[model samples]
Target: MLTKDGCKQLRDFTEKNYKETISEVAEGVWFVLGAGHSNAVFVETDFGIILIDTLDTLERGEKLLGIIRQNTGKEVKTIIYTHGHPDHRGGAGAFLESRPEIIAFEPKCAELEKADLLQDIQKLRGTRQFGYSLTDEEAVSQGIGVREGITHGERRAFVSPTTVYRQDTVTREIDGIQVEMVRLPGEAEDQIMIWFPQKEVLCCGDNYYGCFPNLYAIRGGQYRDIAQWIDSLDKIMSYPASCLLSGHTAAVLGHEEIKRTLGNFRNAFEYILIHALEGMNAGKSAEQLASELSLPPEYAELPYLVEHYGCVEWTIRAIYTAYLGWFDGNPTNLHPLSPGIHSKKMTALAGGAQNVWKTARKAMEEKEYQWCLELCDLLLSNDETACGEALLLKARALERIAEYETSANGRHYYLEYARELREKNKKG
Candidate 1:
C-alpha cells in the first residue's frame, strides 16, 4: 500500500506526463493518446480510413472508434497491426462490424500463435508487471504514457489477421494513401513501422516511446536482441519523417526534433551495450557491471531516457545474459544450495533468526533498505512461521524503497510485495 505522500507523487507524475488528448499529426493522420495502455493512429484516404495499432481492450477500441467517427464518418477499411502484442491488436473485434481487412507481419502471426500456447502464464505475469493488483489510490500510469484504460475491462475481442506480409518492406496504396510497412523489430521481434511518403509521417510501433526502451521486460519474454534493436533504431532514423507517432507516447511533430530524439535514444542503448560488453571482456560479473554502469550526464538528463519505465541497471544485466547465458562462469553457482537451505545457514551464521531480524531492523533504521531486505529474507526463509515480525519489517523497507523509486514498474513490484507481506502478517 502507498502512503499518502507516495500516492500523491505518483499521481502528480501521471498528471504532468500522461494527460489524454488527440492530435491531428498530419493532414489526415490523427494520433490518439490516453485511450488505452497503447496508442492508435487512423489515416483517412479517399476510400476509407487505415487504422494502425488498436488500443488494448474492446471497450477502449469502441471508444477509439467513436473518436474516429467524430472526425470523419469514413469507416475503417483496413486495420494494420504494428506488432503481435496483445495491446496492439487486442481490440480488432471492435472494428469487425466494418469488416476491415486485418493485416500483420508474417512472423507476427506466428508469434501470436506461439503466445496462445503460453497465454495463461503470460496473462498472469503481465498483470503483475502492469500493477493491476494495485488499488485505485496506489495505481498511477502504465509508465509508458497512458494513465487509465489498460485494466478497464478484460474482454479482449481479438480478431486474427486476414493478410500477412513476409517481405522486409511492403508498399501498398490503400485508397489514395501510399504507405510502406517496413520491418524493423525492436521491442517486439515482429514489430514494423508504417511510413507515409506523401504525408512524411511515420508510425513507429513500439520502437520508440517516451521513456527508455524496455530492453528486457521483467514480466518475462524471449531475450530481446540488443544489437537487432539498435539496428532497428538506425533504420527508423534513416527515414525523414516530419511527423513521428509511436505505440505508447505523444507524437513528435517536427523532423529535426524527431531526428534528435531518435538519435539520443539510439545512443543511450549503444552506450549501455558498449560498456556492458567492455566490462564482460574485462572479466566482470553481470552483477558487478550492473552496479558500476551509469548513463552519462548528456544521455541521463534527456526526458525520454529517464528510467521511468526501464532501468539502466536492469538493461546492463540483460545485456550480459543475452551475450552469455545464465552461468557467470562461476562453478559454485552451477550447483549451489537451494535458497531455503542457504537462508537457513545464513540465519544460523547470524546467531539466530531473531538476531537476523534485529540486524534487519537496525539496517532499516540506517536507511539501508536493500541490506535490510536481504536480512529479512534470510530470517523469513529460515522460519517464516516463527519470524512474523520480519515480514512487517520487510514490508516497511519495501514501502520506503518504493516511496522514492523512479521506475513505475519497480515501484509497483515493491509495493505489491509489501502489500502481500502485510496481508500475510495479518493472517500469521
Candidate 2:
C-alpha cells in the first residue's frame, strides 16, 4: 500500500523533467531523429542517404522516413544496423523493401536469429524473467504491433543481411564517403561504431552513450561482458571525430565535446570496474557493494554520466556478479525463498495484507521507502485489482519514492503507474 504523501511527491517530480530532454540534436550535416532514448542516423551518402537503425517497426520506420524525405527528398540507399536490439533493426524491413543495399554486423546477424528466447514466443512475452509482463493475447489486442521483442528469432527470418562484416576492421566506400565499422561489445553484444573519416562523424551504435550502462542485463538474459564492454569503449576513445551520435539520446557535436563526453563515459566504466574488482578482493557481497558503493565525484560531475538508465553502484554489483557467481559465499542467501512464496509467508507473519498495509503507512511516515515498497509489492502482487484500497495505497507509495529518484526511467514508471491507478479507480 502507498501513502498519500508519496503520490503527491511523484506527481510533482514527474512534471518537473518529463520533457526536459533532447529529442533531436540536429547539426548542419546530420539530424538526430529519436527523442530521449530512441533515434536512428541518416548520413548524406553520395547516391542518397545511408541510414543507421531502421526505427522500431515498419510503421514507425515509414514515419521517420517521411521526416527524412521532407528534408532531402531522396531514397534511403542502404541500411546499416548497429546491432540486433529490436529498436535498431525493427525498421529494416521497411527500408530493405525500398533500399538497394542492407548491411549489418555479422555477430548481430547470428544473435538476432538465435533460438532460445526468440523461438519461445510465449515464454518471452508472458514470462516475467525475460520478456515484458504482457500476455500475447493482451499485447496483440492493445495493437502494440509486432511481438518483435518476444518474436525476435521469428522476425530474424525476415531480416537476414545480404552483406555481413566478420572482421574487426571493415571499411566500405558508399557514394563518396568512406565508412568504417569497428566491432565492439557494450549495451548489446553484436555492437559496432560507424565512423566516417572524411566527414569526421562517428555513429557510436550504443557504446559511449551518456549515462551509466546497465553492465549486466537487467530484464534477464545473458549478463553483458563488462570486461569486453570496457575494451570496446577504450578503442573508440582513439577516434578523432568531430560529430558523435547515439542510438538514443542527443548527439555530441564538435571534436572537443565528443572527446570530453567519450572520456567521461570511459572513466565511469573504468571506475565501476576498479571498484567492483576491489570489492571482490575484499570479499564484499553483491548486496553489500550495491548498497555501499557510490558514484565518485570525478565521474558523477559529468552531466552525460547521470543515472538515467544505469547507476554506478548497481553496475558494480553487476560486474561483481558477472565475475563471481550469484552465491555470494553466504550460506543463508545460497538458497533463499522465492518471491511469491516469500511474500505470502511475509504477509501471513505481518497479520495479512491489511496489517501489511498499515505497516506500509508507518514505513512511509518514517521514510523507510525500501521497506514500504517491498511490503506494498507483496500486497499488490497478491490482490491488486480486487483490493481497491491496497491498490490505491500502493500507487501513492510508489509516487512518493518517485520524488527522490533522479533517473528518468524510474520516475516515469512510478508516475505512470499512479496515473493509471487514478484512471482505473475513476472508471470503477
Candidate 3:
C-alpha cells in the first residue's frame, strides 16, 4: 500500500515520462504507444500493412487493431517479432484474422519454446515483478513506460511464428517495402533490430529504450550477454537512421540525437563492464564492487542513462556473477551457516529475540530502514512462532524504503513483499 505522497510521486513521474500517444515517425511508418509500456509499429506498404511487434494480451491487441483500422483499411500482411518476450509477440492472435505471415528469428522461437516449458513459474514471477495485483493508482510506470494493459485480459492470445529466420540478417521485400531483420542479442538472446533503408528508420526492439537497458531483470531470466549487447549498439550506430523506433518510450526523430543517445548508452555499459572486471581482478567481492562502482557525471546525468529501469549497482553485481561464479573467493562463504541457525546464533549473542526487536525498533526510529529490515529478518528467521510484531516491523521498513526507491521494479517489489508480509501477519 503506497501512501498519498508516494502515489503522487509515481503519478507525476508517469505524466512526465510516459504519456500515451500515436504519431507518424516517418513517411508511412506510424508508432503506436499503448498504455505507456507496450509499443507497436505500423508500416503501410503498397500491398498491405506490416506490423512489427504486437502489444501484450488479447485486449491490448484488439485495441491496437482498432486503432489500425481507424488509420488505414489495409490488411495486415506480415507480423515480425523483435524478440521472444511475451510483451513483444503475445498479441499475434489478434492479427490472425487476416492470416498474416508471423515471422520471428529461429533462436527467438526456441526461446519461446523454452519459456513454454516453464510457463507456470515464469507467469508467477512475472506477475510479482510487474505488480499485476497493484491498483491503477498504486502501479505507476514500468520505468520504461506505463503499466496499463500489460497483464489485462484472461487470454494472452499468443500465435506461433509461421516463418522463422535462421540467418544473422534477413532482407525481404514485403509489400514493396525492403526491410532487414538483424539479430542483436542484448536484452535477450533472440533480440533483433528492423532496419528500413529507404525510410532511414530503424526499429531496434528492446535494444534501446528511453532509460538505461535492463542488463539484469530482477524477475529472473537467463544472463544477458554484455559483449553482444555492446556489439549490437555498434551495429546500430553504423546505420544513418534519421528515425529510431524503440520497444518502449517515444520514437526518437533525428539522426544526431539517436547517435548521441546510443553512443552514451554504449559507453555506460562499457564503463560498468571494464570497472567491474578491474574490481574483480583486484580481489573485491561483488558486494564491494556494487557499492563502490557508479557512472561518472557525464553518463549518469543523461536522461537515457538514468537508473529508472536498470541500476548501476545491479549491473555491476551481474557482471561479477557472469565472469566469476558465486564463490566470491571467500573461504567462509563456501559453506555458510543456514539462515535459521545463523539467526538463532545471532539472537542468542544479542541476549534474546526481544532485545534484537528493540534494536530494530531503534534503527527504525533513526530512519535506517535497511538495517531495520535486516534486524527484523533475524528475529523472524529465528522464531517463526513469535514473529507477528517483527513481520509488521519488516513491512513498515519495506514501505519506508519503497517510498524513496527510484527504480520502478525495486519499488514495486518492496511494496508487494510488504503487502505479502502484512497478509501473513493477519493469517498468523
lDDT of 2 by residue, 19-52 (tens): 2232333332455443212467787766688887
> What are the per-residue Cα lDDT tens digits for candidate 1 across 1-428?
12335445555666776667888888999999877888999999998899998888888889889999999888999999999888888778789888999988866323434567887877666666677888655657668866445455456778999998888899989998999999997898789999999999999999997877678887777778778888998998889899999998888888899989999999999999999999999888999998889899999888788777778888888888888878898898999998788987877887877777678888999988889998877777764424677788899998887876677777777877788789998897
The C-alpha stretches of model 2 lying farther than 4 A from their native spots are: 1-28, 35-37, 108-159, 335-358, 376-396, 411-428
Clashes of each: 0, 4, 0
Number of the top-ranking candidate, with lDDT as the measure = 1
Q: Rate the local accuracy (lDDT) of all candidates.
A: 0.82, 0.64, 0.82
**After superposition, which runs of candidate 3 have C-alpha atoms over 4 Å from their true positions?**
1-10, 108-122, 148-154, 384-386
Candidate 2 root-mean-square deviation in Å: 6.9
Tens digits of per-residue lDDT, candidate 3, 50-79, equal: 999888777778878888888887878899
Which candidate ranks first by TM-score, i.e. highest?
3
